[model samples]
Target: MRIESPPPSGIPGIGLRPIERSDRQAWFDYLRLPEVHEHTSWNVHQPEDLDPLFEIHESVSPTSPRRLAIVDLESGRLAGTIGFHTVSDLNRAAEIAYDLAPPYWGRRLATQLCRRVTDWSFETYGFVRVQATVLVGNERSARVLQNSGFAHEGLLRAFRMVRGRPGDFNVYSRLATDPAL
Candidate 1:
């Protein structure tokens, strides 16, 4: 399923929309940066690697793995992306993920992005649980989740591979019943 409109970010000069083909260059410029991918598990090594991500799938279900660009309204630049990594309608659950370019970091943009997407997932998809996994030691990301009302659930031992080696991750989650931040 393709998401046409992203929920309002509540941040001035920032907007969200489905990631498009036009964004591939800008997305790759930052996503492949060592500073940006160091804390996440993105495997992007070249621009072509992101092609699959931009394909618009036609489906009625809103649970498909898709990303929305966090854009700069004035310059029309790709500031970052936030979206669902996985969704399980049967379980009323989904995993959320996000990343911001180096230039856009440290502006509280991540917190707003996460909050808006989490709320949208609950309301739009009828999901009861929205979760996120931060590679261990990615304190900045963990803080974003915490500020967005995701409580740390626990640590998963060797949960994923980061930059080739197995890495642990800290799981966090926000439920529909949780008070909004």
Candidate 2:
């Protein structure tokens, strides 16, 4: 019952693919940026903090069958990454998450990528729902979900122990029956 990784989104100008070792530097560089993690899940990430992720990317295509490295095909660079995590096939649901290189922000790429991925999941896995949560102050992420057609759900007080401290979260989601982009 392995889920195949979703095909490239066919965004006309960009493609997202499973990450590769060659992408290590690009991803590392982006995560290393001080502003990338601001008001998000992590307080800060050292290059060493991502060692396991790089290892997994190099050695495995995880059961999740995800790890999309955003590519600006025109420039052929791995601008960032997005993936579905904590997926539960039996429940026909999954949590969607993503991040882009800071330089790639504000271009609507995040919204586009999220939409493409959600469409693929609903179509391929018959997923009844795709959900996302954001740190309350992460307006950008919330906007991505909204722009991609998700409905705002509610807030979770002290929702997660992010970077070792309790932090509030705002939930949002889109169902298979929701509007299409």
TM-score to true structure, per model = 0.94, 0.86
What is the lDDT for 107 in model 1?
A: 97
Candidate 2: misplaced stretches above 4 Å?
1-5, 54-65
| Cα RMSD, each candidate | 1.5, 2.8
Per lDDT, the best of the predicted structures is 1
lDDT of 1 by residue, 69-171 (tens): 8999999899999988678878989899999999899999999889988899888888899999999989999999999999999999999998789999999
Candidate 1 Cα outliers beyond 4 Å, as residue runs: 56-62
Whole-model lDDT values for every prediction: 0.87, 0.78
Candidate 2: what lDDT? 0.78
What range of 10 consecutive residues in model 2 has the weakest lDDT sum? Answer: 57-66
Top-scoring candidate (TM-score): 1
